[model samples]
Target: MALNAAVALGSMFFGLVALFRPQAMPGRPLTSPGSQMTQPSEATTYFARMYAARAVPFGIATAAVCILLPSQAAIWLLAAGAIELLDAMVVASRNPREAAPPLLAVVVHIGSAVWLMTA
Candidate 1:
């Protein structure tokens, strides 16, 4: 229960960062201090913003359900896990090395789901 809310909040935070600073997103290299970061192409920025938009709403809804309807949170948890799994697959298709974080996210989501089910 708590895990779901925590993860939801974390997702929202990440989404917000990605929305405002897409270059700071995971797998997207960030320039070191003092070095100007190269801006991504229009298509890249567009897609990153799109992803951020999806994440924000999903996290908000998931967190809302977790707090307002705990009994229904498990389904959202599972859905989040599935989303991460698919994200991992997509990253793996492009670059296997970049898939680890999302794969770990998948594990966390599944673990949270299991904890919710057991508790």
Candidate 2:
């Protein structure tokens, strides 16, 4: 439960940052780092904002499930784990070097879910 709450809080923080300051967020650039496009395009910014918007709801839902439905928290944790795993995969596909953070998130989320399930 505590781990879920922490992940939720972290997600909310990152979501807020992505929504408000897309450029500052890592992995927002649509183009490869070696690409000549030094600046992020409007479409990239819009996509980042959309991604950030999604994070907000996901974070809120996870937090709510942890607080209001303790018995169902494990399921929510597993869902979050799956999402993180996907995120890691996407990042890895794009740039293996930049995949560390999402990969870490994947491990933590899935590990927590497994722990919660066994608890």
Candidate 3:
């Protein structure tokens, strides 16, 4: 449980990083440091907004796993992390140029998930 909590906290931290530094993420539509889509297409803006929006939920879920379900948090975290990893791969494969940061995060998440699950 302690390990799970630690992993969850770590995930939460990264999620916050994503929230605050969307551009620092090195991902498409989110490539600039602290970048918010403001040019070319409104679709890019929409995508950035959506990505920012999703961060909150992910952050909450991760924090919940840490604080609310210590005993089973590892299981939940692992599942969520796996889903994120798969999504990251999909994103990367489809657009390698802009998926770098996300791919990195996904790998980190996977490692933490593995640790949480196997701890």
Please name the candidate that would achieve the greatest lDDT relative to the true structure: 1
Tens-digit lDDT track of model 2 for 51-110: 787788998888888778877677778788787777667667767777776666667667
Clashing pairs in 3: none
RMSD of each: 4.2, 3.6, 5.6
Q: Stretches of candidate 2 above 4 Å error?
A: 28-39
Pairs of colliding residues, candidate 1? none
TM-score of each: 0.74, 0.76, 0.52
Off by over 4 Å in 3: 1-25, 28-40, 94-119
Report residue 106 deviation for candidate 2 (angstroms): 2.1
Q: Ten-residue segment with the worst summed lDDT in candidate 2?
A: 31-40
lDDT of 1 by residue, 38-90 (tens): 66555556766887888889988877887898876777888988987887897
RMSD score of candidate 1 (Å): 4.2
Candidate 2 residue-wise lDDT at 37: 60
Point out the higher-scoring one by TM-score: 1 or 2: 2
- The local lDDT score (0 to 100) that residue 84 gets in candidate 2 is 70
